[model samples]
Target: MSYEADVCIVGAGPGGALLGYLLAKKGLSVILLEQNAELGKAFRGEHLNEEGEAVLKSHNLFEAIEAHGLLRMEKLEYFNNGQLFKTIVADPTVGHLGIHVPQAHLLKVILDKTHQFPHFTCMLNTKVTQLATDESGRYVGVVASKDGISIEIASQLIIGADGRYSTIRKQSHIDMAKRKHGFDLLWAKIPAPKGWEPAIKMALIGDKQLSLFAQTNGFIQIGWNIEQGSFSELRKQAFTPFIQQLTKAFPDLTEIVVQHIQSWRDFVLLDVFSSHCDSWGTEGLVLLGDAVHTMTPTGAFGLNSALKDADCLASLLSKETIAQFDVQVFQQMREPDINEVLTKQIEKEQTFAANFLETAS
Candidate 1:
């Protein structure tokens, strides 16, 4: 099959979807493809910093998102050994602040809004298999597979918004900067028991044994950050003992775990920084989102950075000001934020690690 569009964005995640939404709003023909069979998966990145919120507002998505019953967590709380450790209030006068909202829900809101434009098309269950470029090594189009059929979509540009393990970035042979910390994270949620305030994002740490993050749905989005291979050892001890460990770490938090602990999961944290050739476009190809730079979520900046990318791309495409807007504008606009995002993430990871080591040990 063959199709033509002004912009073909791969991966219908936050970045691709939002950028597609903005570009299409400008009447630039855009086609979006996602490998997922459906939306609403448990996406890991979930916070929307105040900067991210402001960007959404500027793009006319803030109100719609807020209306979706997103959790308005007024403070970001970090526990040292529990005991109401510290709080980063949503007072912008001091700095930036964001709240907790499932990233998938946010994406749905943007996609729904972007759909209002006739130029926008989101192809679900579609996978971009190959990048087609001209003789000059310029990206020209993409070949994707949907169901039993192979479809080729040619556009003025191809944008990759896939996640951390980006197939597009790997396939393009672009150099990627990667850092791995042997530390990993285990995440889960438990129902909130009586007297649990479920209104704020609460983190409790204890004896270097467990960490908990409280969620809004009368439950806590709990994570147990441990040494890379240590989780398996801990899991072997059974959930009851595991919850006990959390209680031991923050004795005050014991009540919640004893009553509200429901379940949990483990994950390895990674920090990735990468970019395409100086030519984000050989002819018409580009990269966006984690496909470009997968930042370790520290200050809850992954979504914010992605929004920054989408906003810049939207601004460029919407204006179409430079006549020939290609790789240069893309790189120039993206570099600073990408760097800032990476630098900021690394710093946070380090800080979290140090704090954990100190408190837990």
Candidate 2:
């Protein structure tokens, strides 16, 4: 099968979906391709900082997302030696310390909105195998297989939103400088404690950090930091002591943790990494979100930054035709802000111990 569009997006993540929606609404034909059969298959970090809130609100999408489900965090608390050391209340200027919304709900809502436009088409279970290039060696589109059927999707422009391990970026040979944060994460989710306030809780345990976030679905998401490449050795040791340390930080959750998290299999290991591509776009192809700048889940900047890219790019696309699109202009407009956020995330992770108390007024 052959399909042609004014804009071809290779991933249905936040950046691609949002950009597709904006372009289609402006009467431009857009084809959004998703390798997965549905949304929310991956462990998308469900966090929205103030910048994200502002972007959604600006687009008049925040109300719709909140109507689906949203949890506004009340405060951020730090614990030291099993005692509360500091508390940082939610700032009114910043809206809230954090907002949690399931990625499934957010993406579904955006896609549903896009469906209202006749120019938008979405393909699920479609995986891109290689970049489609012209004889001149310029990127023209992508070749993908859907349900074992090979299809050629040719477009004026191809947007790569396939995330950190992006096939499009890899196939295009866009080199990304990678960095490891010296630590990985163990994530688990269980029912929230009864009468628990919605907040982000952090504790220093064994020279590492344990973070608990209250979810909108009445669950508590726990992320424990461990030395990079040490999970295998650590798993061989007993789990009781580690579980007890978590209970010590929040004693009220002892019974809940005991009931839900029994074995090592209950936890999911997250390999932490940060990377930035040497360039974001070339000619007819461009990259966004984790594809161009993969972030550690430190400051919850990944999803929000993707939205910013989509929002900015959509603004540019809505005003100009594909022929007028300059990939350099898009890069120039977005790179500074992206770098700023990246630097902030790195600084936050590096000096967290030293500035732990300073964060609390």
Candidate 3:
């Protein structure tokens, strides 16, 4: 099968989906492709900061997503040895320090809005095999396989929002510099105890950071940091002793933890690293979100930055004709802010332990 669009987005992630919707709303033909057969098949980095909220609101999407389901963090509470020592309340005007949005809710709202445009197309269970390039070595389209059927999509602009491990970035020969944060994360979700407040709770456990985020749908998401590349060795240890630390930090979770997290199998390990590309695009192709500037799950900046990227890129594209598009301009406009966020994440990691000590003192 063959298709054509003004823009072909290679990932139906938050950034890509939002970009597709924005472009289509502006009257451009758009095709969004996702390898996953369904949305929200996996959830990661669902937290949205103020920047992301503003972006969604600017597009009049925040309320729609909120209607689906969301939880607002009321404050950041710091605990040491299971004792709450310091609390930072949310701003009165904003009413939230951060918001927990399930990827399922966010994507469904955006894609549903996108479907209102007759020129918008979403292709699920499709994987791009290769970039289609012309004799001049400029990307022109993509060749993909959709449920065992080969398909081709031609577009004037190709966008790679495929994620940190981006095939489009690799095929475009974009160079990315990767940085390994000192820790990886073990994530698990358990039922929230009745009367749990919507807040982010932090604790220091043997120099590692443990966090509990109150999530929508009556759940608490746990993020436990471990030394980089240490999960395998750690798993060999007695699960009871290791899991007991969680109860020590938040005794209130004892009942739920015992019920939900039985073994190491209950936790999902995420290898954490941040990356940045020297260039976001080449000729007819461009990259956004994790594809070009991957952020570690620190300060919950990754999702928001990607949302801002989509908003800015969509604005820029809306103002230009396909023949006049320039990816460099977009990079120039966004790189400074992105670099500042990256630097802050590193500094936050280094100071995290000290912050606990200072607060306890």
Top candidate, metric lDDT: 3
Location of the lowest summed lDDT over 10 successive residues in candidate 2: 352-361
Model 2 gets an lDDT of 0.88
TM-score computed on alpha carbons, candidate 3: 0.98
Best by the TM-score measure: 3
Model 2 scores a TM of 0.96
lDDT digits (tens) for residues 62-168 of candidate 2: 89999999999999988865667788998777768989989988898899898688779999999999888888887898899998899998888899999999999
Better of 1 and 2 by TM-score: 2
Query: How much is the lDDT of residue 219 in candidate 3?
Result: 94
Q: List the residue pairs that clash in candidate 3.
A: none
lDDT of each: 0.68, 0.88, 0.93
Cα error, residue 265 of model 2, in Å, equals 1.2
State residue 46's C-alpha deviation in candidate 2, in Å. Answer: 1.0
Model 3 Cα lDDT, one tens digit per residue, 1-361: 9999999999998999999999999988999999999987675989999889999999999999999999999999998777888899999998899999999999999999976798999999999999999899889999999998999999999999999899899988899999999999999999999999999999988999999999999999999999999999999999999999999999988989999999999999999999999899988999999999999988999889988999999888863577678899999999999999999999999988986767554
Q: How many steric clashes between backbone atoms does each model show?
A: 10, 0, 0
Alpha-carbon RMSD of each model:
3.7, 2.2, 1.2
The C-alpha stretches of model 1 lying farther than 4 A from their native spots are 78-82, 92-96, 198-211, 229-241, 250-282, 318-323, 353-361
Q: Report the lDDT of model 1 for residue 4.
A: 86
Q: What's the true lDDT of residue 95 in model 1? A: 43
What TM-score should be assigned to candidate 1?
A: 0.84
